[model samples]
Target: MNAPTASHHLLPQVQARDVPKALLDALQARFGAQFSAAMAVREQHGRDESAFDIPPPAAVVFAQNTQDVSDAVKLAAQYLVPVIPFGVGSSLEGHLLAVQGGISLDVSRMDAVLSINAEDLTVTVQPGVTRKALNEAVKSSGLFFPIDPGADATIGGMSATRASGTNAVRYGTMRENVLALEVVTASGEVIRTGTRAKKSSAGYDLTRLLVGSEGTLGVMTEITVKLYPLPEAVMAATCSFPTLADAVNTTIQIIQMGVPIARCELLDENTIRMVNAHSKLSLPESSMLLFEFHGSPDGVKEQVAVVQEIAGEHGAAAFAWAETPEERTRLWTARHNAYFAGVQSRPGCKAITTDACVPISHLADALLDSVTEAQEAGLPYFMVGHVGDGNFHMGYLIDPTKPEERELAETLNHQLVERALKLGGTCTGEHGVGLHKQGFLVEETGNGAVEMMRTIKRALDPHNILNPGKIFSL
Candidate 1:
């Protein structure tokens, strides 16, 4: 295998795992119309946004509920076939790729907001409910879910990756918000982990273990997550800095001062240009920091004053505010569209993205070094970051036809991950270790730790069937 990270990045050495005719027949007979063997449907479930082009799964099972998911898994388990649970398919890493042939268990239809406990500030939702949908469901209650991974990622998918996004600075990621899950084990048995209670000393903490397990452990059917009362006041601002360092430094200072800023994001000039062109906005073309403050009216004002003062000290041009709800929505929508903008900037190119997160104290150094390396590599690229927490992603757009370019991007990514590890940070912050970062996992967490992970995988999925060949090889 030519180091499978993205789909195109890996020149395959292994053939698709064999899927027996008997298993397909049984699935079709049991699921009836829910089962599909069409090439288009299989292809759609087989790959994610990653540049990988693995062969499509042999079939797809459109699961409608917990019973559907359980039955599908049981059938696949009978033949020791790999089962990949797919949500919105918005993952950047190769999380959805079926490197070993089997069946894709798509759960998009299982979307349901099971309950909204506004008084307790919690909500129960099915695995396929998208983030935007969840927010809309609880909007009337004056409570909102905070995790937004840009894409309208499903709650289940977010849980699998332990995803965090813009609001992570204040509200935290999936691991912090997710309280309970109903999961289907590899043997097709259903199990519930965690409770709606805020705290529990209840043994193994299986909730945390499965939160970021990346689907190698089990498939989550229902998710119960924490919610926060909507802030009395919300403020969004964009500050352009003279240089990228200035913006990164401003972010570092803001965090160090202990500001409970809701969201702090960084976008380089190139990314700004791309988003400007794609989103039809007239944002300034310079290194910029996007900040959002959520608190009482006076509290938001105080935060704005402190942040503006810090930005002024770091050579900020001017602070622009999106005061109205519509304006704020448009601005944030554009920001979330940055990835599409970058990919479109280089037509027919694959973005080999990096997710290296370091400590807050080393944010500036880590981000700057990675940017410099990308520039030196001479690739069409753009940069965006959740810098308040020292996590950033650099997208290196490369022509898949040019193997050399792909290799160059991989080298840059490897170097960046190595540097971040030296900084005592993770190789991946939000994006889970799909097929791409397995080596980096070993480097970051040592052989012993990874071996323990394998031990867990073997324990949960002895046949090596659940999302096989992902996170790490068994």
Candidate 2:
């Protein structure tokens, strides 16, 4: 959640050259109207959902195909200008920002569902295909893509950030769902890694390397990701707890017992109140757990019974079940809108989100202490998370004009990351180390491992033109 400070000057600018007029003219001629140098368009492409100050790109390229992406990158390579891949600009971190001032490669126009192998339970999509679109496209096949990051983000952006969401507890994150990727390297060379096969012992696993690279190593043009068969019977439930510890403990027990919960989300009383006002729903304004169970009817009932017993032990209230699809949608939709609800609760305020993931065994300690710390600091914050996977976010809403408020939020984030690291977790569970977590990345991985990453970056992008000043510095 911290903004960029002065210490992030480790990497040298690529040749220290401006995006030349010649390069912009060449791109405009090659792509015609798809290329734009208008300040408004450039400004729109530069900023994302992050709270960072806007750093606009020199130009914008609306790439419609892999060839278009290659051409843009090829041209940028020639001019030694950085190429930042843009996908919906829904990212919470500064992944899409043109920090070094170059080209914003907009891939949203390349939206397409290339292939769907229902029998194989795999689908190939262009970079611009959003998660909801993919799920809707495959609905007839009785299968769905499960990695819903709640923002309706593009598949390419999801794959780039290694996104996970409420369903990640059971279906897994992008790292597990993505099978292969067709990438455009820094030199504009198109390459394919991995295949549709379920398993591969082929080579160095470049698919993973590029998956969470955040477009630093290359640009992901196409993705083949695993899919899941829709559950025969689905049931959603909400239960309130006496405190955050009680709710987290209930989740810990459910996961530890090997229950296959499809989605398990944690929301605090503050978030619950905001959701009630924003979504027009009435629910208890207490620490609550929302859960969804998948499988046959009997399986779901058994899972619910077991979870009910677990919750009862923690002094949880009676379960509120949603048996119908419409009812389930209403329940989950409220959960997804937690961010907007929180933002609207406080006028003229922005949320500085924190993503801290720890092991299941450590969830209770990690969450309870964090909530206590935030309360002690007197910061207006709300809590939500995919707790079934030991990942959660704390949205610290602060006025942009208040420097002290931003500083407090950043301090709280720093403490939370330190706590997660000490508990054998990561600085970022799903969000990559985009400008926000570079310092934490070092604390978590140590300098030697970071240097190894730098080595890879240099070998792959010697010119430092592909999304420079992200993850780590050279």
Candidate 3:
């Protein structure tokens, strides 16, 4: 067996438990084909995109609906076994790892578009529905969900992580867009939070609480999200700058001027080089910014002019725009696949991703200092960010076979996160505190707030059977 990877940096002493036969027999009898103890299934459900190496779950339960999730939780609670909710497994913070032996409740099969109220600009969907699938389902209605987290991530996973992307600056992230959710609690009780009409002062704000809880408190079954009408005219563009500082300055000025650009992404020279090689494009090997403007023709043109003026002042060169939909898709697709491109740049290398956010005023200093530190440490890393919102990601490529390389990567991440916090930022901007940033959460929020979170977790899941040992341990 492999040594289980715990996100806390310290190797947790979690022994594999002897799963009770009664619970297994009951699950197999009641759920029939929906339950499986196969090693292959368990292993698949145990892993995520994070670099952590963890033990597989004892079994995998395919939940097809909210009731299935509730029942599975009921059984797990009865046996006092951890229940780890599995989505598409795209999480980078070790959210899906079954560190302690338990059952993986996969909700990918629960994909269903429950309803779409075009007039209300809202869509209700099952936890399994991916972002692209939801857009395709409602494309004809001229409405789309703007919370694109690069991956074709499931809606449930995005909500659970409170994911955001390039468009977050203009529209919003899962935290802002999710209006309601039907969640199954630790005790197998189904509860609804928020409402369709929006703006509710009803009791506790359970919806927001569970949105980024990382399935540690409850399993979200149904998610109601806000949607935006598709823009009449959309334009995509890319600009090259002489230096990273120039690119960062241009982004800062653009945001400061209140440009209503839909998407603004910053890619450092190394990331651009990797992307060009992976995407087979001749983009300049220089610090670059990718942007998209969404609005009427006049509105987009006005936004573009304001952005161009700012870029020009910062020594931007080779300004280009994608006029056709095909061209626009190709440009954004390359941006979306940046993580893969960075990984593929070094074969057999794993990416230790960093998610840090600061106030707009501190983004440049925080980003520049972090970049300087990584480069000085002699580690290979790629940079990309939704600079419009002061949230960015760094994918530090490391050869997993080399322990020294992992150590260096961790060192760089620690320094980067420390700088962000010092600048009044967060340890994680979008990626939830699954396992990776548990210690940093304490540093960022102080002991009192973290203790409050633990208190809430204990109150909700008294048995500690809901994804135990993640976010924070009791």
Candidate 4:
């Protein structure tokens, strides 16, 4: 029999009573009536937005405060049970999978805007605060948190994933926005890393270390992120291209010319078709570039003029611009809905997305080649990109019931990763290597670098009780 088949041989059934009683007792004592056996709704918290099927946590704890998280982690540490931090569960990668079957610390109950310091241009928020909620809360203050990942994902999950979106080109990503964090270590000690200062040469950059750690190192309780002042003028526009190459090339030109564009996203014809069906927007079935500019009226006009000239040289068609706030919002809303639209295009199909980032100069070639390769493989795929940042996503819709189809999809994904690495790019740009890209990480970073990462994981999570089976396996 094949190894995969042999491994699937009905293993000895394990009962819930096999779990450590001491840990359960401790949790019962700590939470009192707040905890319940029904909290073991593993099916609800097991998976993320990814296509993987993994086991959920043994129990779920709705943490309402930092102390609640601290206590939960402490008990899990005492019994050496895995503790996975879960947010909105909107992660594209399998970041929230409870592979070790312990406790999932759900922090959505902790949602609160702790403080908004307009003078400092920063906001301190509990982990559960969503990006949309934060934006609405600060709208009256004329400030906004600019890192938007399309989903109303919790601040904790976004920080954990180090997510970036269309606005990253102008406002920067979580790496640039997250000024500080209050974290609970594996042993349950609470510690704060970084300050509210705009710039810091301070101690080791622990804030960044935790930002993209994907919840393996610790649980984030509070986050302090930089805020940007609302732009005086915002302009949204869309331009179509005769060919994919033309659209990608135009994006390269726009970035090379250093036009202060807030967001520059590309959607291939395949994606546009899906969007039209899903969003009911009758857009031209051509590769398109969605752009946004933020500045004074004169600055916006100059930026748009330069972009138009560059795009026109590359055979851009129907360059429509939206100047009003309502119009701009409508434009962005459509763009943000692209992922859902792509998924809805093929009913009963799950999306297996690949995120690769390359140097700006190689982006056009890399993306064009990827689309061609996917086509040659006879795969149904769509491409959408944050072109200005040289990051893109190739979402392949596959039927989970077909084993051969799944294998083919995996093969295509592997080829895409190989191509990315060959072009001096990373397998993942925003999404972390949560199980799906572990092999890719080894191939990209090499064994030596991976060992260093494992060393850090060991140092921080000595018990391996924090998000076990993530980033790297023991």
Candidate 5:
């Protein structure tokens, strides 16, 4: 039952390129107070939620507007210094790391919604606008944006990584919602891609190219995304199952049956216990599926009835309905906090998080076997999933002082990724191929495909001055 062992997915050895003093002088002179060479700022922007311990960027530039981003990138391009576009630093992958010496371009100050075109069901926003902020801004319009990656992530970062979350089962991911973008090229040229129109065949679809490029491509300055009408009625419920398989099977059945559930999430017993302790709530400490149904009142009722039948057939217990908005918020907030719960479950421990997504029919195959491997390994771990879409996250909590545990955890992750790939799935669903998953990306997509990716990177960022040493090595 033990996880099949594989070599650790080691991070690339990044050689720090020296940052010329002239570049620093130019940036400081140009940006004044907006540019920082402060060690604290550098350190803060150096790492993300990922475990890789790379040195921080040499400097940080807080961009307050699209002009600021363009100017800063232009300055960096002049010195041929690497520029890593940063959001709120919520990235789970080592996306923000200055693996090569560079400047961290902080765009959180650009948090402004430019315009809300309610009539057109579209909104134009600054790259620094967070998902929660955008939703709050548009809630009054009766049209809401549905792609949320659970961390209150910036629309810019989400677009860069093609992020999706719980509601992706129905609405879709950032790749679908992002309609257009204003991107600053490696040469410091500002270019627009796509338009407000929903569909277009006019050109190369450069918008899609940049959506999931993970900042290795260009710096996104402005974004326009589609909005959806708020559902007439929303129902949130939790169903505890006798076994993890029952919970997953129930989710698989729900999707296969075309239930159109807004969110169908799975949390194993271990994860539920951690979340309960962390969030101070009494959720049933068993394998559980949290469901949210959105539609007309009658339509929601129909969907709920159908899901309940599916759960019953899979041995799920009675549904615990969160009928009120407050109750539903509490439940989802707790679900969103699952990563923190897993980390805090053991004091001072860090979790090496990874996710694998497969075809709906192969979800059980990809998830169940991985769960068994994790159980047999005897590592302290927690599991959760956006099961309606066949994407599951497994976090292996490890002691930093124990290198052996870290190695074991990585091996487990490698095994899981391999399994998902064998099952016709991806190594990462939303987290993107940051420093950690570069090797898996090659394995999953092949050398030729990765070479094509490298070609694209070279063609766009000729100097490799933008988030270099990410996605793939030149």
Candidate 6:
């Protein structure tokens, strides 16, 4: 891998004045109805799941295939317009924002499960297919795709964000599962990286370089992901602890013992209260750990016994097990809806979530200290995590209309990032450095690394047309 030398250059920024009538005329002539002036509806494709509302794109192109993307990119390049690729629009860090007002290239129309190679246990999919949709398609095949981000986010966006979820502890993140990618480079050239050989010492590892690039380097048109066989026997259980530390300690023990646990999640007392109120489930108002075990019948039984003993040692109470499939589904549904529940607890409040990951041994201490800080500041927050992987989310409810409240929340969010860095963790665990964490990224990676990233960005996108003002500033 060759790293470019840092050179200072003034990158061009797109504005309303830069809208080329020639480009629009060309787009209309080429795409007909697929390209229209109505695409100038910046509100539709500009912002994402972030708290800040950025400037939207000057146009939105509904691409149906790789050729469509290439055409759009070529036209944008000719007009010097920034192009931003959009997926399900569920990005938490404003990855979809078209700040410079160019084109928002939407690929949802290209969604399709292209092929399923059952023999090799891999699947090829168009970028627009969501994780839930893929799982539904593969359900009957007795296989499953496990990179879940709690949102039914598009595979393209998931790969771009390097997303992970509850099952990541056992299955791994997009970085681990994505075997290959068919990408459209900044120059509108199509290329494929990686193969289905299961392992390789391939040059440069372009698959990974683009996986978390957040559309800065290229546009992902298709993804090849590794799949896993569905577990034969599964068991899920919930245990309440006298304190958050107790619950986290038990989770630490379970992981250290290598219990083969599929998912181990922690919900602080505040989060549990919110879940009970919103989901209408009667759960004890104490910190809880939701766990799932997967393996053969005997293996699951043995693992469950070991986990139970560890929980008992940590003084875990209300150790209820959900053995049936229906019960397990309901339990997980409740857990997945926890973020929504947290917001519903406050009728007029919007959620601003902050995620950070650390070493497993430090997770409990980090979580406990975070809760204490939030309480001392008199902020309303809920906590939940995929504990086995040491990733968690803190949901803060804020009055968006109040500037003071928003500023306070921002301060707390920055503090959280600083704390994570201090504890030797990335500013973000799953979410990429879209627009939210660029400052923290500078702090985390420092000037030298960021300079290297900028050099790569300039090398791949000299015209600054691909996702301008994201990950790195011009």
Global lDDT of each candidate: 0.91, 0.90, 0.90, 0.85, 0.91, 0.84
Mind giving the per-residue lDDT tens digits that candidate 2 earns over 1-474? Answer: 344343331233434349899999999999999999999999999888778875599999999999999999999999889999999999887888877889999999989999999999999999999999999999999999999889999999999999999999999999999999999999999999999999999889999999899999999999999999999999999999998889999999999999999999999988899999999999999999999999999999999999999999999999999999999999999999999998999999988887989999998878888888899999888889899999999889999999889878888888888889899999888877887788888889999999999999999999999999888767
Q: Which ranking of candidates, highest lDDT first?
A: 5, 1, 2, 3, 4, 6
Best by TM-score: 5
- Tens digits of per-residue lDDT, candidate 6, 204-276, equal 9999999999999999998999988999998999999999999888988888888889999999999999999
RMSD of 5: 1.4
Candidate 5: global Cα-lDDT? 0.91
RMSD of each: 2.2, 2.3, 2.9, 3.5, 1.4, 4.5
- Going through the candidates in the order shown, the clash numbers are 3, 0, 0, 0, 0, 0
Give Cα distance to truth, residue 464, candidate 2, Å: 0.7
Off by over 4 Å in 3: 1-8
TM-score of 6: 0.94
* Residue lDDT tens for model 1, 1-474: 134355323533656678999999999999999999999999888778888778899999999999999999999999989999999899988898889889999999999999999988999999999999999999999999999889999999999999999999998999999999999999999999999999999899999999999898999999999999999999999999999999999999999999999999999998999999999999999999999999999999999999999999999988899989998999999999999999999899998887878999998878999899888878889999999899999889999999899888888887788788888899999988897888778878889999999999999999988988888876
Worst 10 residues of 2 by lDDT: 6-15
Record all residue pairs in model 3 with backbone atoms less than 3 Å apart, i.e. clashing: none
lDDT of 1 at 123: 96
Give candidate 5 regions above 4 Å deviation.
1-8
lDDT of 1 at 86: 96
**Which runs of model 4 end up more than 4 angstroms from their true locations?**
1-18, 32-36
Q: Spell out the clash pairs found in candidate 1.
A: 7-51, 7-52, 7-53
Candidate 3 lDDT trough over 10 residues, lowest sum: 1-10
